[model samples]
Target chain A: MNPADRALEDLFQEVGPERAPSHLHARILAQLADKAEIRTVPAPLLARWQWILIGLAAMGSILLAVMLPGNGSSTGWIALLMDHLPDMTSISSTLRTTLIGGAVISGILYVLDAQLNTRVRPTHG
Target chain B: MVYTVTHRILRNDMDAEEATQDTFLKAIRGLHTFQGGSRFSTWLYSVAYRTAISRSRLRRTEDRSLDEVEGRPGEPGSEAQGTTSDRRRALEHALSRLTPEDAAVVTFHYLHEMSVDEIVTATGLSASNVKVKLHRSRKKMLEILQEHLKEEVWTLRTE
Candidate 1:
């Protein structure tokens, strides 16, 4: 830093930190005492185990569908679909499209939520 | 420190006080997850800075210039401004001329003795961005300081 910059820093040092009000400390302590009981805020809607089970059920359904005996175009298409999981032109087109659409929309919503609600909730703990 | 930053940004006692409370509470709760990676003060400062920034955005009050002295607004170094030296008033005026974010950056980098990296962590700004802000703010402060000094000289010469 140049002398002028250093001098500016010195000026800031001179300015110093502003004093906080005396009551703020007391107010915070009282609020903390009140908030102590509700520290363990459970995630809303789906519980952890519930989500895991849902994921497993979806995977199982997909596996069962892939294995079910099929005739005609599905035979070769399933093999191709397995290779290209995102291929939406198979017998499982409706299911695949719905699942993929849901996932993508959920992801977009999640990102939007994260971005828009950057406001720190009063109880971030 | 938390109160100081918030007061500087919000320029309002009620808002700053509320933000200070929030910052302290968040810091206390977050203390458990603090893995001793950085100094405890740095971490606390980061929480304070974020809380202040958040509160400033949330606050609906009209913005005031840095040039506004304690009881007086607009007139940077009016007679009501009390016993502070002219240079100090000039610095404050210059500081107020910048955006609130830049003022906070200058405060964190200089008054608080925080490193560029620390500011980046505190403000969630990139390292390069912090450095650039510091550089630009310093230059602006220098220019403001010079103009203020010249005005002082002119006032004294007339007196």
Candidate 2:
């Protein structure tokens, strides 16, 4: 090491370790007490499981909708609407297309918003 | 250690105290991940270093130049006696002129007695980068001492 470096090392050693203010220990203990209180409340497992199940069900519904065979004949609500409202069938096709597109776009936006707002909760190992 | 590291970076007593508190709180919260692969002090210092850096970034306060530091030595001869307190003041003034990162590097390298590898872990810098920064910081500190305590520094160097 150079003389300058040696001089600095000597200076730092002469200074020694600094002592923190006396109250800092007390302050840290107080904060730890407060944190301990907050941590005691266990996370709600049921609510988390419910959200997981809801997500899985939603995903399954989407997959089923995509995988199921598409018959030429209208089924369920569409068949009922077509049977009772034959005069409105032309506009119904355009409206149905618009609603599906809107729903898909809304789902995408919702997922993105959720992702952006999600906070990483600290986990204890 | 936390207080000193934070003070070196923040350059404000109150801010350093607050950052020291935050550092311990973070360490407590993240204790489970410590894994004990290195010395505990090294891990703790790493936490303190990061907290101080983040606090410094958030505040973005302007660092005072060497000339701007209050009670700086007016003449080189004035510091020749260089009592312990005088040496302390000189070091503090010199550290004040350095950037927070450079000060941190010096504090860890010299005061904390951390090895380059330990500093690499603490600061998240590569070995070569830490070496480069350490060299630059040492050079800057030497320059500051030469400017402020020319005779005393030379005497210490020759001793």
Candidate 3:
């Protein structure tokens, strides 16, 4: 910048009020604490709505299967159906337990994604 | 320090205090992602600038209609009186009329005394952009001060 412009800007040095109120530092620190609290906040469990929906779906499916009329023969249609659905029954109980465990993991992930989305993205909030 | 920086931007003590708090909160939340690419002070200033800008924009938007009698938001304390105060107020009034980027240039250059390189790093603007902003802001400030002086002279003559 030119010397004249430099001098003009220098004039502003004497223009602003003195340092902002001292309590400002304490206030900022307090706010920082609040933010840390928010960031460290543990995520909430998955939505109760999701659990309710899954429960309702499972119950509805079970009722529908039981309510369906079956041939009244000695063929034991229910047993035959269960036998044909080998993929569901053949897995070790341990593997089945692991598959159920994945639901918990995915639920946590879903909740965390929702929380971060709401907090970080203003449009979503 | 946050308040000091924000006060420079907003020129309103209460608003500055609030903006300072918000800036620190934002900084804390994003602290994990703050790579050490720039000085901590510069990064902090950038955060403060953004917070203050957002707040003032919100205020302006909320009170959009000019007929709403937008009185100055805070009291003009004794701290903001005298020739020093008047000159500062004059500069501030003019500064408020400038764009946020322009006001930022004035603040960073004059109040912080940051060099061109420092400003470029702080604002993420190219050196040429910084120079252009600085030049334009300085010229605008000169015109503002001249108009202020002219008004003062006119007032004196009438008296």
Top candidate on DockQ is 2
CA lDDT of B51 in candidate 2?
Answer: 97
RMSD of 1: 14.3
Rank by DockQ, descending?
2, 1, 3
Q: What root-mean-square deviation over C-alphas does model 3 reach? A: 10.7
Q: lDDT per residue, candidate 3, B25-143, as tens digits?
A: 77877777678987888888888877887787777655446425775432233443336656666677667666666777678878777788877776677899998887777767666
Q: What would the per-residue lDDT of candidate 1 be over residues A11-77, giving only the tens digit for each residue?
A: 7787677777888887888877766333443333544465566556656565645444342345566
lDDT of 1 at B69: 35
Candidate 2 chain B worst ten-residue window by lDDT: B71-80
1 against 3, candidate with superior lDDT: 1
**What's the lDDT for residue A45 in model 2?**
30
DockQ each candidate and list the results.
Answer: 0.24, 0.26, 0.19
Displacement of residue B78 (Cα, Å) in model 2 is 5.1
Which window of 10 residues has the lowest lDDT sum in candidate 1 chain A?
A36-45
- Assess every candidate by TM-score: 0.58, 0.63, 0.55
lDDT of 2 by residue, B95-137 (tens): 8777888888888888888899999888888999888887887
Give residue A64's error in model 2 in angstroms: 37
Error in Å for residue B7 of model 1: 1.6
| lDDT (C-alpha) at residue B30 in model 1 | 76
Off by over 4 Å in 1: A36-125, B60-75, B78-88, B149-159
